[model samples]
Target: MPCIGVPCTKSLVRSNKHHLTVSFFQATQKLPSVLLAAYAELDCGGLDLLQGELPQSIANELAATAKAIAAPGKGILAADESTGTIQKRFDSIKLQNDEANRAAYRDLLFSTEGLGQFISGCILFEETLFQKNQDGVLMVDLLKKQGIIPGIKVDKGLETIPRTDDEKATMGLDGLAERCQKYYAAGARFAKWRAVLSIDPSQGKPSDRSIAEVAYGLARYAAICQQNRLVPIVEPEILTDGTHDIATCAQVTEKVLAAVFKQLSDQGVMLEGALLKPNMVTPGSECPTKAKPEEIAFYTIRSLARTVPPALPGITFLSGGQSEEEASANLNAMNKMGPHPWALTFSYGRALQASTLQAWSGNAENKAKAQAALLKRAKANSEAQLGTYAGGAGGGGAAVSLFEKHYVY
Candidate 1:
C-alpha cells in the first residue's frame, strides 16, 4: 500500500497514524504560537488572571507566608553586621571581642523565647549564620524552628568614593547573585543592602548624582535578590549630619526615598516581596534642640508615607544613634497615631543590642541577667510596635552612648 505524507508504507501503518501526525505538527508549530499567546497574556495581566483560570494552591500559600512576614505590628531583626562593627561595640563595653563572643551574643538573641510574636525575620551576619548554639544546633536552624525567617546582609561594607572627599559607596555587588543563592540555600529567605547618603547643607541639598547612585544601587540589589528568590530589604540611609533640623531631615529623606522607589519600579522589583529599612527622621547630633518623640514619630511616618509605595512588604526604621528609649518611644507614637499604610517597626542594631551587651560584659555568670535585659528591650520594642508601650517601664536601664562623629559607613 502507498503511504500518505511518508516515504514508507511501514511508517504510515502505525495505529492512529493520521491523528499522530496532526498532533506532532500541532505541537511543533501551532502549539508554540498558542503557548506564546498565553505567555503574553500572563505577562500583561500577571499571575492573578492565570491563577483565576488555572488553580495554583502553592502560589496562594507562598503569598500568604509573605503577607504574614510583612504584616503590621511585625518587623525584622537586623543582626547582620560585620565583625568589625560588632567589635567596635564590644570594644566599647571593654570586652574581648572575638568570633566566639559574636556568635554567643547572636545566639542569645535568636534563642530568646516568643521572638516570633514581634520579629518576622532576622538578618544575620555571615559569621553568625553558620554558628551553632551551646546545644550545637545551627543558628539558622534555631530561627526556622521558632518560625522566624533568617536573612543575610549582603553588602561588604562601604567603599570610599574615589574623588569625593567625604563620600562612599556600598560594595558587594560582585558575585551578589550567587551569594544570594547560597544564602537562600543556607536557610536565609531574605537579604539586606544598605546604601549610605549624607546630608551636605554645605553643598545645599544632596547632589543629584549622589541620590541617583544610591537609588540605582538599591534597585539593582533588589533585582538580584529577587532573581535568587530572596526578598530584599532595600535601605537607602540618609545619614544624620550637620545641625540640620528635623524638617531638613524630612525633606532629604523624602527626596531619597522617592528616588529609591522610582528606581525600584524601574527595575521591576516585586514590591510585595520586599521590605524597606529606613533612617528615622530626626535632627542631627549638632542640632542643639532635640524634637520630642511625638514630633519625630509624626514627621518620620508622614515623610515615609509620602514616598514609599503601599505595596511594599514593610518599613523597619533604623535607630540611627537614637537612644534605645527614644527609638522605642518614637515607634510607639507612630503606631499610636497613624493611619499608616505599612508596618512601622525597628531593625535597630546599637539601639537594641547595646544595653544587653553592657549588661552581659562578656561574662558567663551574667548570662541570665543579660538575657533578661535583652528580652526586656525586645519586649518593649514589641509592645511599641503595637502602639501600647508606656515609657519608663521596660527600658529603664542606663543608656549606652554609641554615638560618635560620622559613626556609620
Candidate 2:
C-alpha cells in the first residue's frame, strides 16, 4: 500500500504522479456537519500551536538572549564611544593616538581571558567593527566565539543646535534605520544611541523643546532597532556641567528618565529587550560639596526606581567622568543597598579605560602591564557588580577636582 502521510511520495511529485495517491474523500465526507462545526468553534487562539505567529521556541530564545545580556551581577563594557573620545583619554596619559594604537588598545581589552565572567556584552564603535586583530581574526567573530554579544554604537557625535548657541543635539537620524540594518547584518545584536542634555539652572528647568527632542529621537531610534531585531541601549544623558547638588541632579534625572520611558512606551518599544545607560546622580563639577560614593549610589538608585519602568531589561550606570575607584565604589554601594527593581551595573568608558591607558603608556613592552591593569579594573568593577568591591578604600576621598573651571573643550 502507498504511504498516506503528508510527506508521502504522491505529495512530493508533480501533477502527473497523482494516480498513485489514495483518496480520502469518502472519509472526509462521512464526518458529521455538527462535528466539523464544533471543531471550527474551538478557540485555537489559546492553543500553543495556533497562537499569534512567533513560535514558542524562538520567543524563548530571544528572552534568554536578553536575560543573558542583562543578567544581574554582570554588566556591559562600553568600549563603543567614538575614536575622538578615546583619543582624548589616550592624550591624557601622553600616549600616541593613532588607528593602530586604538586597535591595539581594544585588542588588549578583548584578549583578556575570563572577561565573560562579568561582562555580558561589549559595544564597539564603527571603526572597531571592521577592524581585525594582529592574528587576522575579526573582532566581532572573536567576541561571539567567547559567547559575548557584539553591539555597535549607532549615533553620530552630538552636533551644536543651530539656533540655540549654548545647546547641542545628537545627529545621525539621517539614514539611521538603514545603518542599523547594516550593523545587524555585520553581527551586531544590539545598538546604542546617545542623546545629550545639559542642566542649566539659570535658563530654568529642562526646556520642553529639549525634552521633546530627546524623547522623540530615542523612541524613533529604538523603534528602528526593534524593526531590525537589535536591542537598543537608549542613553539620554543630562550632562554634569552645572554646580548643582545631588538632590537637583536627582530631580533632573528623574524627569529626564520619565520622559524617555514615556516616549519609549509611546513608540511601542519592547522594554524587555532594551537597556538604559544613565548618568548616576551626583553633584556637578563646580559644586563645592561632593557626595560620598554611598550617597551617590543611594540617590541614583532611588531616582531611577521612581522613574524607570520595571519592565526594562536593565539599567547600566554611566561613569560620566567618575574616577575608576569612585565608579567602582559607587556601583558597589548601589548593589549593597538592599534590593533594586532592575540590574544595577556599569557602562563605563573613561573610568574603565583611564588606568589601562596610563599603564600602557604607548610602549610595546608594557602590553602585559596594560592588560593587567585593564583586567584589574574589569575584575574590580565585576566584583562591584556583586557589591563586593574592596580595592581603594581610604586611598583618596571622593572629590570633583578632575574638572577645571571653564574647562577647555
For model 1, which pairs clash?
Answer: none
On residues 1-409, what C-alpha lDDT tens digit does candidate 2 reach at each position? 3322234454443221223222221222223233324434666522113223333343333344566777766777888857667767777778777888888888877877777777788899999988898888888887787677888999887766655635656678889878888898888888888887877788874676777788889988987777666778899887777889999998989888889889988887766567888989999877899898778876786677568765565778877777778888889987776344466788876666666676777787888877777677777888888888876632342322344242212
Worst 10 residues of 1 by lDDT: 17-26
**lDDT (10s digit) by residue, model 1, range 1-409:** 4322334445434323212222221122233224324544664444334323212332232334455566556667778778777777788778777777877888877877777777787889877877898889899987887788888999888877665655767888899999988888888877889888788688654777778878988999987887777778888887776789999999999999999999988887766567788998898878898888777876776686568766564678888877788888889987776434566788877777777777888887887777677677777788888898887744455354446567653
> Which residues of candidate 1, in runs, are more than 4 Å off?
1-66, 395-401
Residue pairs in candidate 2 whose N, alpha carbon or C atoms collide under 3 angstroms: none
Candidate 2, superposed: residue stretches over 4 Å from native: 1-62, 162-165, 393-409
C-alpha displacement of 39 in model 1, angstroms?
16
Q: How much is the lDDT of residue 141 in candidate 1? A: 88
